[model samples]
Structures are given as structure tokens and as C-alpha cells.
Target: MPALVVFDLDDTLLDHRGAERAALADVHRMHAAHLGHHGVGHVQDTYHAHNVPLWRDFGAGRITAADLKRLRSERVLHALEAHDLDPETFSRDYLARYAEHWRWADGALDAYRAVATRFPVGVLTNGFSEQQRAKFARLPEVEALAAFAVISDEVGVRKPDPRLFEHVLGLARGVLDRPALAPADVLYVGDSFHSDVEGGVGAGWRVAWLRGDDARAPEGAAVVEDWRALLDLLEIA
Candidate 1:
């Protein structure tokens, strides 16, 4: 077993996409007048188109989290012609709803329990501190099992920035009481190809890419389609 098993919270362990869709539905309902003739699907597609690239920029150190949040909201509202709504207010409201709608990915709780029992488990995710904490607070199962959860907003750096991964590794070593722990002893799992797999591999750790559909896995990285597959990869099942 690996000395440490680290996970990315969004999409990998938590159903962030589900939460986002539900939150967007809430936001759309709340702002139907401002949103004009656009349906929820249009809004979701427009928002995702604007959001995904900004998140990639965030992971690449090309933009700050605050900038990504503000810009994505501004761009999405612009695309939807929702000029009457304030982007900042919309973003805040959406995030609040998102926090409340937290859901676990399939088998997340079981995988977390299994991993936590066999190895020190931690979370390294790129997200707002307060929102992430709120989600964790709602899921006592995850909170109790995690040895650490390092958020980019709190760390002032995001992945695939090496600093965030290094910080998690250092904390994992200390928490696991393995002073000599090295990169090889860690296995990092996440859904994003750039942020999780590339970042973990760049940090000299083994990576398990939690991919769906027909996404290609990078060389030397494990690819799993679901939490059950991930558990199998970790030898937890």
C-alpha cells in the first residue's frame, strides 16, 4: 500500500458536476427575468464553456482564483445576454447554492473509508476555502476520514502548480508519522487531466486519473472510470 493516498475533491470524490447543475438550476430560477429567453441547458453550456478554460488557466498559474471566478461569471452572463445581473452577486449566490447541494460521486464514501483505513488519506483540491469547507462540513464521513484537505484559495496557489502538491505531501508525511516519506510513497487521484494527473506526476507521485467516457490516460498513470475502479487500483477491494 502507498504511504499516503491523496484525492481531489471535485468530480473525483464529490459529484461537483451534479452540485453545479443543481446550483445553476437554482440560480436560473432565482433570476429568470434577468436570464431572458435562455433555458437552463443554454445557461449551463455557456457557463461551462467560459468556466472550464478559466479553471485551466487557474491550474496553470496564468490567472488567480478570484480572477477566474469573476471572469467566468462575467463572460457567461455576457454570453447569455444577462446584462442586468451583477456577475459578482451571481457568482456568490451560485456558490452558496453549490455548497448546499454537495453530493458524493458514486462509491466515494466507501472508497474513502477503505483508503483511510489502509493509508493516510488527504484532499488536494483547487477551490474556494469556505465553499469547500462547507461541503466537507456537510459530509462528516469525508471530514472524519481525511487526514488533510488543502485548498488553493487558502494556500494562495493552485494545481498543477507544484507548491500545492508539495504542501500536501509535507503535511501527509507529518500526519502519517512517516518522517522519511518520499514522492514514490504517495498516490494522487483526481478527475482533471491537467490539475490532478499532470500535477501529481510532475510532483514525482504516482497518479490515478479518474476519467470518464473516452478520455486518454497519460503514460505511466493509472486510469479509472469510477470510485470502484479507483478502489481496485488502490488494492482496496
Candidate 2:
């Protein structure tokens, strides 16, 4: 049997990190209506300085999702002394506006589509369910291609954790009732060494690293620069 192919969402297939930055830039353009001209660079800088560290804390399991979403943007406004800004209102608004500005890398959808045709495909990523599912719906129609995954908040766990990896493969194997596959049959593809590679390796599945930086992992498997390169790595060409 051909292997089951799993993928990461953020930098792997959807260029989520890029999409987020672009969305922030777009949001800056729109926020001028309320925040005023001075508020532009002010809010932007404060947002980055405050939000990035909070997210890092979140990834390290140092914060709660409620705190992550509610406080991140709110703190930015607070730091900038924009006391009039309503945290809850603007956070939701920012989500919608961000999604609107979402963009995908070249050949991203086509690459996933091509892989989906020949093997069982699933998305194994770390993201908020509502947000990630929205992005998934937008491009590659990931939900249509892969019916199973372990999203961060949804799964009550994050990547680089072996149990979460085990959970994803187990679900993919139809383990909800009867097991249909084994760990060896799935190869998880992602951009993070700790999350994707370590998680998959620890869980006893194959791994493919979607390398963005010069970072290297000692584990033996495939590595590609981007989605299109997946074709070559999988020898689909």
C-alpha cells in the first residue's frame, strides 16, 4: 500500500505565517479609520512587541487560549494607551479582517491536490480550530481532502508532543472504534523540527521536513523547501 500522507498547515501548505503578517499590514490600512494616523505605527509596533512574546508563551503552554485571544491584542492597545479600544470587539474584527487578507504561496493548492489523489491525506497542525478551519476551507479545501486531524485547541494538545501525534495517527487509522492502519503507514510532513519531525518520529511514523531555514534534525527522512518540492521528495514527478 502507498503511505498515508499527513501535512502541517502554517508554513507547510498554507503559508499561514505569511498570511498573518500580510493580514496585519492590511488591518493597519483599515484601522486608520478609527485609530488615526499616529495610531498606525503605534499600534503595529506595540502589537508585535507584545503579541509575539505572548504567543511564544502560549506555544510553551504558558498561557490559556482564552488569555491568548483575549489579552494579546488588548495588551497592545493598553501598552499604546489606546484606552478607548474595546478588546473583544477589535479581536473578533481583526480575525475576520485577517482572514479576508489571507494569501497562499504559488502552487500550494495544486501540490496538495496532486498528493491527495494518490494516497490518504490528513492535516496535522497546531492552530485555533475556528481560524485554521476557516483557512482550510479557503484553500486546498483541506477538510474535503482529509477528514481527520488533531488541531491544537480542539485536541487539547500541541505538536512536538508524542501523544498528540499518536492521537492523530490513531484517529486516521479509524481507531475511534476499529483500527484501520498502523503508525508506519503514515508520513507526517511539516516545517517544524520539534513539532512535526520529533512528534512523528516519537510516534513511530515517517517524517518529511518542509525546511524554511538552515535548521537540521538528526532523524532520517525527506526534506523540502516548499509544497511543490513535495512532488520531487515523494517522487511524484
Candidate 3:
């Protein structure tokens, strides 16, 4: 059976965290013009501090997408008391600017294309579809290498959930016009242990922990720090 390769989106394949940081800097500039230095950083700080928790809530199905966006804006506004800054309008404009500034990790495309020479590549990210599709637009090369692209919002399920893995795997198989490939034949590579690494293994695919600074994979999980090293781990080189 041909080995299928799956990848995570955020820090593993896409530089989302970096993109977010950069976007905040832009917000700082935009707000500083109107609100001054103290005012600008205030909004930036408040939003960054609150966004992760709100997103965690979002991931767990506790809130709607639109609600999360609006509330995030409202929280920042309330904290800074930035008058005339409407949460709804600010959120919409911020989303647009943020989406336009996506970046990809180094060696990501070369790594995928090298693997693509022999195996099918698919993306499985814990993100919304429209957001993800917009992200893909920023990295043209990465977009071309993948046979299937899956996101949590589009599938209505997040990583660590076996259903999302299975759905994406099915898409990869369909790309090859092959329906009988078991989950084990696919190789899943991701940055997060809790969601991507642990979850992929639970779904029966061989998991490869994409090394990041903040966390390590659970005991007994295989890991690859470099993108090219992935091919070597899979015995592709």
C-alpha cells in the first residue's frame, strides 16, 4: 500500500502564531494612530490575553464563530474603553486583514513536494474552513502539493477527534481513487501532542510528532524535527 502523509496546519505547516503576532503589530499601528501608544498596546494586550481561552471555548463547541469574534472585540474595547470602536465592525475588518497576511513555515513546501513525489499529502487542521481556505491562498505552493485539505470548522469536528481524521483520510483515498486503504497506511504529522499527535494515533494512523518548542509528544510517540527528516522516518529516502 502507498503510504499517505497527513500534516497539521498551525505551527507545523503554517506559521499561524507568527502571523497572529504580526497582525497584532499591525493592529497596534492602526490603533496607535487614533488611540495613541498606550491605547494601542492596551487593545493588543487585552485581545491576546483573552483570545486563547475564548478560542479554547470555541474549539469545545461552547460558542458560535460569530459570537467568538464579536466577544473578543468587545472584551478588548471594554478593557481599553476605546470609544467609538464597534466590536462588530472592528472584528470584521481585523479578520480580513489577518487573513491576508498568512505565512508558511520554512522548508514546508520543499518537504511536502519531496514527499508528494511518492505519497499522497493531506492537511488536517483544527480551524474553520473559510479561514483555512483563506490561509491556503497565502501559500500557493503548499496548496498545490496536498491532495486533501481538512479543517475542524468545515468538518464540524476538531483534532483529537477520530471522526475528523477518518474524514480527511477518506479524502486522500478518494484522490487516489482507492477506497480500501486502512488508516494505518497513512502517516500523520503534527505539532500538538494533545490534539494532533495523540489524536492521530488513536485514529489508527502512524503518528509523527512535529517538534515545537513549547511541548513534547507523549511517551512512545515517534517524532521528527525537520521537514526532510519526515521522509527519512517514513523510509522514503
How many clashing pairs in candidate 3? 0
| Per-structure clash totals for the candidates | 0, 0, 0
Clashing pairs in 1: none
Q: What is the TM-score of each predicted model, taking all chains together?
A: 0.90, 0.80, 0.83
Question: What is the TM-score (0 to 1) of candidate 2?
Answer: 0.80
Expressed as tens digits, the lDDT of each residue in 1-237 for candidate 3 is 337888888888787766666676676666664446455455556777888778778877799888788788888767766666677766776676677667778877777777878877878888778777777777876668888777788787887888888888778777878788888888888888778777887888888887743245554357787886777886766
Name the top TM-score candidate.
Answer: 1
Clashing pairs in 3: none
RMSD of each: 2.0, 3.4, 2.9
lDDT of candidate 2 at residue 107, scale 0 to 100:
70
- Give candidate 2 misplaced runs (Cα > 4 Å): 33-49, 78-84, 175-180
lDDT tens digits by residue: candidate 2, 198-230: 778788888777763444654655677777677
Give all candidates' CA lDDT scores.
0.83, 0.73, 0.75
Decreasing lDDT order of the candidates = 1, 3, 2
The candidate that achieves the highest lDDT relative to the unseen native structure: 1
